[model samples]
Target: MLSKFVAAAALAGAVVTAPAAAFDKPQTTYKVFQFPQDRIPRIDGEFSDWDMVPESYVVGQDQMTDQDGGHHNPDKTLNIRVKVGWVKGLNRLYFLYEAKDDYWDFSLPGLHNDTFEVVVDADLTGGPLIDVQHQDIWKPEWVGQRASKTDPRVPGSLTHWYSHGVQAQNYHIMTPHKDKDWAMAWGSPTWIKNFPFANAAQSYKFTPGQSGTYRLEFYITPFDHADPEGPERSVESKLREDALIALGWIVIDYDDVKTDAKNGFWSLSTQRPMFGLASDLPLFKLMPIENAKLEARWSWKVVDMDRRLVAFHDDSVGKATGWHWDFGDGTSSTEQHPIHAFAKPGSFVTILDVTGPDGTSRRSKVWDVQLR
Candidate 1:
């Protein structure tokens, strides 16, 4: 079943017909801080873990604009600061959201609560990703019409089951949620917010109607093809160093509980429809770790079991002048990256030694390479 899903996902990726739409801020690109694997932030809703991040990485209120007629007053009502991060070898994006609102209104049981809405287009496969924005199926004349499951104009394949949220993702995260799930994975495949794909933690000291500060910490996996069925049919976006992805966020502030009108829609992207359109999101580059010390790290893949061929990759940090590999079979090589055919099929310990101006470092894997 897993193999079938992988094949389907690969086929979908290959048949992509539309080009990514032009990004909103073409002249500007944001940075996604890279966290060392050992220094990844904890999702405890505490700011102490983020002390290592520089002030430059913080996307503050100055970057957000009130798209809803500029009614939002940060100085008098709401203020927010957000930071994004990623770790190498992991297909996940981490976030830290801090906000202060004059009146925190989250008493509602549904979509009326304050929200930190996030949208991600990992591969930049542009166009409308939500069902309501489907160009051909969703008619403009039905704008104010009530929705019905049996409506002939809207098909389940286009509206609810397959298309929406499969290419890109939208997360409507309830701010300081009390009696609801942390976020609503706004389309099909609601399992996207569960463990292994996403997790969230929020902290607040005040009641729903009180004014106070709120902190939210969370991480989510971006998918290139997030199938409506589940993970078995999904393709996670491969996250790497120095790669660019499209992402944006909106702060949906609701000040009063009496009326249904929202206070403001402050957004990171200049385009107002960024929430539903993947192309409108801004570019965010995954940055390399700063001031990193020289360290040795390596990985291996079994190229061919019949020939006992194994390929090694150098994933070391910082500049290195030399490398040494011990195949643990009484043989060795000095290649930075090497492919070796083992003498026979057996579990073998592998080690890589790197030497640079800084110093020498070593990494070893115990009985990891097995050929049969």
Candidate 2:
């Protein structure tokens, strides 16, 4: 039988270099599809695209430049904000990665269970790999039991930053599935890869119900493992930067896909690692605004002196290029000319931000608004 898992080094000291990736191109991948009838149902919530992509996440951040940092360039590290998208019956987050010459770690801080291990079998035309193995790693309840052996030491080990018990308060490794047989050598310094090593860090997401978002991350770097497993003192920061680029990463959401399952199998029993932080993020003003009923251009205006609803000839303003008027009240408006009425009359500071395609804008002033 083709082994469910491949031998990394003849189960011991034999190190075989990995064959080239068969399909260099990524698969047109999408997260698990959500169904309207599922557990949480695709109703009464907000969803949007992840604003950030997975970049190399450094473990030890003792300075502006970390010896164990992934991508040195702040501009390159992931700045996840999730700019746009709709949320639906999304259940869990999944991740698949190969550790050829990189240090990779997946950290899900506050896990709500509901994650899956995504493994892909690359069928390269001219490849030496005719077999592949897939398995899930579960967590053990031992006092301080953790992984001892490390793999993919060509780069550094990012897991050094997260130990099972020692990191309980700040962070902890994701426990694998119980039934699945996986392998990880844990120890003092160099466990996830090799001992006196620069520490590293990474992140992921998980969701308990089909009503949240999912996130994932990965990182890599040059390896230095002579005394077993740990960090090194290399000053060449570019290596860390190069490692980040070499280790491609991404984050995705799956709420629109329709699954026919009426009942959700969403439970925290599973040792799934990656998950969507389901706690509702405070809603910022939506760009394509919300509850406007209109899908086209909308505008609004306010007078500065009396903070009164000053009319700007609703139809007098030529087609506006761009504008922003925060009514300060819960309900805001912007159209050919927007007029908003607060639940009660009060003094409000109206901030208007306007810009045109020709790069021209004029703010009348922060109008002191009084409504009745």
Q: Residues 1-372, candidate 1, lDDT per residue (tens digit)?
A: 013443354345332212223777877788899999998888877768788889899999888877764554433478899999999988999999999998888998988898999999886665676755455644312212223455435546334445567778999999978899999998776889998799988989999789999999999999877877789978898776766788999998888788767777889999888888877888888888887778999988888878988999898987789999999888999999999999987888889999998889999999888888
After superposition, which runs of candidate 1 have C-alpha atoms over 4 Å from their true positions?
A: 1-21, 69-76, 133-161, 328-334, 343-347
In model 1, residue pairs whose N, Cα or C atoms come closer than 3 Å (at least 3 residues apart or on different chains), thus clashing, are none
Q: Which candidate is the best by TM-score?
A: 1
> Any runs in candidate 2 off by more than 4 Å, and if so which?
1-23, 26-210, 215-228, 232-372
Per-residue CA lDDT of model 2 for 1-372, tens digit only, reads: 112133223233222222222222122111221111222211111212121222221211121121111222222221222111111212111122211101112222233222221211111111111011111221121112234454322113333222221211101222221222121222232242211111222232332222222222211122222122233322111111001101111221112123321111111112111111111001111011122121122234455434445543221122345556666666544553566545556766655545544343434334345554
Per-residue lDDT for 156 in model 1? 62
- Model 2 residue 353 lDDT score: 47
| Per-model lDDT | 0.80, 0.24
Query: Candidate 1: lDDT of 112?
Result: 89
